[model samples]
Target: MRIGRTLPPAAAPLSVQEVLSGVAALFAGKRAVERFEAELRQHYAVPHAFLLSSGQAALAVILTALKRDRPGRDEVLIPAYTCYSVPAAVVRAGLRVRPCDIDPRTLDFDWERLEEALQGGRVLCAVATHLFGVPADVGRLKAAAARYGVAVVEDAAQAMGGEVNGSKVGTLGDVALFSLGRGKGLCTVSGGIILAGSGPVGSAIENIVATLPREGWGDALKALCYALALVVLVRPSLFWLPRALPFLGLGETVFNPGFALKRLGAFQAGLARGWREKLLRLREARLRHATFLERAGVAAAVPLHGAVPDLVRFPVLVGDPAQRARLIEMSAEQGLGVAAVYPEAVTRIPELQGALAGGAAPQAEQVARRIVSLPVHPLVTQRDLERIAALFRAEQGEQKGR
Candidate 1:
């Protein structure tokens, strides 16, 4: 059966203050970047927030700092089911990542397996991911890290306001990072922030962010595209992109930005600046839709609470891989953009194909097959979420009747 097309809420929104912020970027060497970074510190109560070119760059900067602690030692443990950027960041930092299995139930490493990875004694640092706002068992992982004296890097890119026991996710780890890209909890139009863990560690991030050259025209265009995308998100039927191509508007294609580029056109750059609070408002709305789905579920979902999840994609564990593939196909049939999240397990990726010590990442393999992601971005609506749950229910019904 073919699913119908539905449009989500806007990914970007505008307010008076936001408009003013964009206007200010007209001047060069402006503290607009620093202002945004300062807000992060105030919001998370962290001492530092080093804004960088991209999320991956933020990771590279942090990992490089961690790498300095152990020259010639470059083994970092990453969940087999994670973003391409995570592993890429490790490699860019001149380190090797050891892919580990994650608990299908929690979407994190079973601390036991993490311990086993550490037993190999190659682990210099660990990147713990709070995938889809479901907090990794940070407390337990913290205890384990303390025991092993391994520095835990919190990849809170997808977990902005996501919390555990009232504390924010970013505050829990030694060095926490967040991605402010489109569809994240807050869309900063291609910006990243690294939270300082220690005085020296935080200093390193500041130094890195300062040294990275600015992107002029690229940043402006990204801002405009994001803004346009947001404007269309509110009107599901009138979305400008659906009719634009064969999956061209279906997914993001142009996000290429480098260290140095000519200054952006004044108009485009002006459109991309400020408006942090307005973005937060939309992000909160998305979280509400997510809560509804979690509470009234066809498949179990993690409740993200009041905190903002950067990538509001909810992690779901289908009964099996076959079921997940069917569901993804079905969601698309409904005109929803479903994500594979992490389709191929870490051990399966060509980069680590032969280098892995273990034959297979059984836990990573299991979760990779079972886990599917749902759109929890600022654009998804209550109606959209209910439609999503209904689709899943229909899938189960079809299975039972068979």
Candidate 2:
């Protein structure tokens, strides 16, 4: 075995048994996909669910569906500080994106800005993302969106197992999406699940899903390759190779809207079901790690908004941007999985300049500069946590002296 530190951002952690099960699923054909979808519906207690190629594709599908149902409305409101994919998916769905500022404290859309954006009648849908597995105030988001006759789409891409007031995160909005990509709460290599409530909108999404094309053999093969590669390269020790290779751009955020739209491959669908039971354990471990850091007072306390969030990553805010960079460097030197969440606010991304519905995103910009995330996945051990905590304190002390 390679002699190196073992902290990782996230891991699929597939055992020999799980690998064999996935191979068996390749032969099981469509049943594998159906079973996977069934498991998600049952787990989230939602009436309907559909598997797609990626979380971005799922967002595109939801936006497309909403636009089709409400042709007159063309704008989709989203938090300024979100994944670049959010705007990419909106553009792919042929809708304009209206940026809403986020509240620095909660790292979610600022209520005042969100309300003002919704009040404008052109908004068809408003997205509320459970950023980094921290639940966004979905109840309030829903109420605000409803007041303007807009649909609410929950982005649980980084937060599959979180709950808000005893209700699951995905079930809070009219429609919701969960990512099964590598490093997410759950890994299906490269896939996503859309859970919709049983109603007219849900029924429409179901119909659209039925009309969607099946995953091709090439796509399936690629997904299998991705699954295999994730198993090999997701370790903190191995991740450096990708980060060092400029072409790979492992940690750089880029805005690219051109991507394939396809159905979830059977191999990934099969692999996803085999890992269903592990989700709760992973969530618990992350929560424990996060709680430890919060109690230790290493950083600002994360506001939970009365919800037990299944955090995918524990975010820490360093008041100084340079210090945040230093913290990431210190953690990386120890092979700990720590990194900045986004390079900058989505609106600040150069490639996306033309698409923004101009709004000042002061809080979002600050978060981009100051926030760094620490891994709390199942792969993180208690000893690893101790080292991480100690390293963090040391860094903080050094920064203080400087």
Candidate 3:
């Protein structure tokens, strides 16, 4: 459940209308995809931006490209405390995933351990995750990468609007990838953007998308449901179907990872209405909600760059893993869902099995054990925030008592 005011599902009519003139039918419309890419390029101030089908696709493309830069030297350093998708992206790119430890305080890679991995493995590329929307301290990482001659493939899937200092995230690496798929700040229904540094990078991704599958009727139906869910998710109270619906096997909201609504001859009018009238309003409400949270001292705010997140999920630290588990259990009972994101521990994943196979990463271990994400998007309600903060405080008290 959210902790603050949520945006309405889709954009308002006038706002959608303004931007829908060139709206492409969901999948087949290369033009819309290209336009979205252009928007990303301008938004991120990058030389090239290639919109892909999924954020994982973008990461896979970047990793694959890096492998092209170094044949048979298949290794990419990933923080042990990120999404499974991070390492999975590496494997999908045909490179070995070498998980590394992260700094618990910063929610970023531990530079010393990372340096050790880069030097020891001689891996030419590294994946930087701005876990919980906080940009990793790129200065240290970037410096080390330069010295090691390692390319960075930023995993900005959880870091859409995250930034370092004043610099935008996607621009920090050789390739900055974003997620517009479901569960992201910008719900594009299903798609990802890869901000390329050169035309070749963009072209390579386009080539890959060509080989991917298209949406079928089931997928189309799923997309429609997701579209409706966006509206419902924004106002869960307004649209949450009765819990009884579950008995009918009619899941109230459908989230299909593979669904892609194509650019159809129809929906042009709706697109225009949504782009102009709907998105702007939704964006404002989300920003407003985010600002409220910041004011409430719930989480620190970062200056967002490309695709300013309408809502962000904050990685709130709770030091004790045992306490976190207790809180998760309690929150679930109260109908608040939570997730650990990824990496059982960079130390434990099979891919990073070779590097420091028996070694322990103090910082990464602490983070993996303690980090718990909370909803910071527009979907959060005021009551939700108060309850969450209260719960966090109460949890700390229990832990201290223990």
Candidate 4:
């Protein structure tokens, strides 16, 4: 293991002030949660904003609400190559997962396949994800879903601060969810934000959120501990310690559907005390790093159009799996923070074998094998970017020689 600075594949480091704010919030009561929700509503220009324990919980709540609106439609359309948490949330809401094939170049759904899925008549809603902060064409998706009277859940879990055509991403769909988990654009240690319009769907969402339990003192204390740990350990210099410990599962992609469904903890909301300013700073830094990687031409990046993504991690495609594995291994040795985002497409997850409804997603599968995300978080340095570029250049030379 490297003894020097070891970059985390992705991170949004908590400041000492943020942790102190969280501690103080433990005693602030519901005011903290309400204040945060108000800020979310104002920033996103949405009338209804709710905070949940996790992004998956928020999604599950939204799915449940949408399902109630149209009980006959039980299936949710999702990109086959999205975060596993997506499908897991769909299943958690007791909805069937119907994954649409995605375009490898953009990480968005393959338009033809998505159109075909929308016409299937069983889809209650479709999730338009801004994967790796790269915006998916939600306008077109909404147009299609509207034809079938289906709702669109914008999955902005990794794109809290992204923008498209000058409009914030969270405002694009019927309802949107943003994750405030660790490594996301804004870090609250752990939390989720939901934005919805003031309609029947919003009322249903409010009702469900009201019924959920809030995090008790015990949960608040645990979140504080986690936030404190993140404040120190998330840095490149000390990150290697936790990364070396196998039990920590530092960068593993998990697919478990069993997760707590509760309101966002006061402490977690407090941790985001100055989220607007902090989010902007983080987005700017990530954009700088991502631009460097894109200019370096180490690999082909996910395409972007009319969108300024607040990229948490810059994703690139390495065509050969063996070469991709080598790049990841080398990155680990040098502490350069390159990561293989997910091991496989949602259609291939063993746990969801019988739960999913879709045909083969060959493009999604290919992307699963070829894609790797490079660090673009604020913690990454100019030297780190150069080192990462050099590593990819060396790999290309080796590939050519073979």
What's the alpha carbon RMSD for model 3?
A: 6.1
> Model 1 over residues 1-402: C-alpha lDDT tens digits?
332355432244334454445656546434655555567678788888776656777888888887776565568888877776777777677677688787766678866777888765567777888876667776777778777667788998877766677788789888888876655555555666688855777777666666666666656666656655555543455443453446644443222223321212333334345444554665576667666766665444344454434446666777777888898777666756555565577777776543444446787777767777776655566777788878877888887898
Q: Which prediction has more favorable TM-score, 1 or 4?
A: 4
Candidate 2: C-alpha RMSD to true structure equals 2.3
List, residue by residue over 1-402, the lDDT tens digit for candidate 4. Answer: 778899998899998988889888878989999999999889888999999999999999999999998889989999999999999999999989999999987899899998899986899999999988988999999998899888899999999988888899899999999999988878898888899999999999999999999999999889988988899999999999998899999888999889889999899989989989988899999988887877776554665432336788888898589989999999988999999998999989999988888788999999999999999998999999999999999998889999
TM-score of candidate 4 versus the correct structure, residues matched by position: 0.98
TM-score per model over all chains: 0.83, 0.94, 0.75, 0.98
Local error of candidate 2 at residue 391 (angstroms) = 2.4
Model 2 poorest ten-residue lDDT run: 299-308
List, residue by residue over 1-402, the lDDT tens digit for candidate 3: 433333222222122323234233544444554565566677777767665556776677777766665665667777876766666666566566676777665667777787788775458687777665566665667788877778777777755654455777777876777776545545555556677766665566556556666434465455555555544543545423422235733212222223332322222222322332344454565566555545555443234433334444655666677777887767644544343444366566654454332256667767667766565554556776677667666776776897
The model with the greatest lDDT is 4
Candidate 3: lDDT over CA atoms?
0.57
lDDT of 3 at 209: 52
**Candidate 1 vs 3: which has more lDDT:** 1
Whole-model lDDT per candidate: 0.65, 0.80, 0.57, 0.90
lDDT at residue 225 of model 1 (Cα atoms): 61
In the predicted model 1, the residue pairs found to clash are: 3-333, 3-334, 4-334, 9-379, 18-275, 184-310, 185-310
How do all the candidates rank in terms of TM-score, highest first? 4, 2, 1, 3
Off by over 4 Å in 1: 1-5, 8-20, 233-235, 238-280, 301-311, 352-359
State candidate 3's TM-score: 0.75
Q: In model 2, which regions exceed 4 Å deviation? A: 1-3, 304-308
